[model samples]
Target: MPGIHPTTYLFAARALRDFGDGFVAILLPVYLLLLGFSPLQVGIIATASLFGSALLTIAVGFLGARRNLRWLLLASASLMTATGVAMSLADDYWLLLVIAFAGTINPSAGSVSVFVPLEHAALTREVSHAERTRMFARYSLVGALASAGGALSAALPDFTTGIGLERLTSIKLMFVIYALVGIAGGLLYARIPKRGASHETSRTPALGPSRAIVLRLAALFSLDAFAGGFVVQSLLALWLFERFDLSLAQAGVFFFWSGVLSAFSFPVAAWLSRHIGLINTMVFTHIPSSVALMLAAFAPTLPLALALLLVRAALSQMDVPTRSSYVMAVVTEAERAAAASFTSVPRSLAAAASPALAGALFAASYRSWPLVICSALKIVYDVLLLMQFRHLKPPEED
Candidate 1:
């Protein structure tokens, strides 16, 4: 850790956490099915995880301004470790539900963990306004690539079964690995400086002048998150399994390629933001991706659906880095942590509401409803975002 930059520690921690999330997202539904739970139960557990993350994130946002972010990050890492350990050992429905709510299992490609707002605030402090977007892009790229690797690793269970290992034992081993990754992430986070080189203690409220803008953005983000929850990776994997009878190995391969496409798009998004501005980059790229998702829901053949899904993956995530940069750019330094938490909390809650409904639809054999609803709502969010924010450029833009 001596020669490494502090930001590098953050990047490494992100990679470890994201790798765990990526595979968990793919494996959660399958694991639940193996345990004799219905799809609705799987969706409920996913909601519990997001909802708990939102509540914890709210606490972090409020406390982050006063506490050492390094300690807070370390604490989050500890919770992640505990979550994984509990998950590996528990099979009871109620106990698993409790762990899902209290632990760090993510059912989506994007994280809603307590780590997100903390890391966003930390990353913003490490770079100047001019460099913020690209820094976030690199941060996101690291996560995406690591997630791709994790997605590929989901096939380990399939391979292990071939070697005469019990399928259930192999799946449980993945959770144990998840716990180990949390410990590894904790070690890297410990290397981060206790405070930024330019850090200063401030007693001002976490949100002041930026309160109105932050609230509005949070509302809009909530809409998008709600739409996204319907197609959270767990549910999407369920769709593939039910719709096409995809094997776990096949789903793993598809998601790995999808994650890779998303990872590479981060830099392209940074470049696109420079040319078209963050809001434009977010809106324009998003519309087409939503359209692709909608079409994929109706595609008749497996190949056609997979091809459309890959197209959606490539364009859908271009907004991620840009969105993080935009939020950080608009808020004051003191408000950065609060701003991140505030924006993310609503998004998490909104996202938490839908998975159950999507699962119910799937349970009823209306397999396409979730995807269609998700795409339509996402398109609406994109249009609304452009209308409200297109002219409200960030400080760097000015």
Candidate 2:
């Protein structure tokens, strides 16, 4: 740790956190179903977790400008530990719902926790304007690969059960492992050097001259996130189980491959952004992914559907690093932390509102509704984003 760069610690911590998130995104609904909860309940629980994360992220964004970010990250890591512990211990629907709401459970394919903005701000500070996009691409690459590995680990319960552990107990142990990952992440965050008092004093107020741009971007991002919530990994896994009767092990393998594709696309995105600009790369790549998702909704066979989902996976996430870099690029350095939070909070809240609706659609036997709706809304978001931001290039782009 001493020889490593500070950003390396952030990347490592991100990988650890995302590994836990990847499996949890896949296993959460299954675990809840095994505990006798319905799909609607599962959706509601996912919503609660995301909604709570939004609130916590908001608090961090406000306090982070004034406080040491290392401490904030450490605190988030602690909440993650508590979340897994509480979830593993509680079986009652109401109690589990409470844990999901108050804890750091991530029900999506990507992280939407308080840790995101904190890490983004930290990472932004460590690089030059020219290096930022590639740096973020590497960060995304690390998270994606780690998440893929975590997806593969979702099969651990099957291995444990085969060895005579009770099936339920085996599943519970996964949550225990999740708690352990949180503790490990905390250790990594502990190694990041803190900013001095002079740096703290010079920190700009949250959302100053960039307030209008941030608000507009936050609104667009919220729409995309709301659409995305319909197919958050947890709900998507539920769909696979209901539609294709996909086994848990099979889902793990499929998502692992999907994540791998997404992971490798990060650098490609960085390269593409250099040629076409960030706005073009974000919009053009995203539209194809959404189209793939929409087509997947109507696929008659599991193989075709999975193939399409994989295609979507490959292209859908190309915007992640670009978007993060773009936000940091446009805002003043003082506004970066707040910009990250402000943009992310609305996305989190909008995303939080949709899982229950998607679940209800599932409950009503409209199984493909979520996928169809998600694709449609995402396409709309892509078009709107391009139209509004195409002229507003970042400094590096200029």
Model 2 whole-model lDDT (C-alpha atoms)? 0.93
lDDT of 1 by residue, 22-82 (tens): 8999988888899999998999998998998899999999888878899999999999999
lDDT by residue for model 2 (205-261), tens: 777899999999999999999999999999999999999999999999999999999
Error of 2 at 104 (Å): 0.7
Poorest stretch of ten by lDDT in candidate 1: 195-204
Query: How do the predictions measure up, each by TM-score?
Result: 0.98, 0.98
Clashes in each model (backbone N, CA, C under 3 Å)?
A: 0, 0
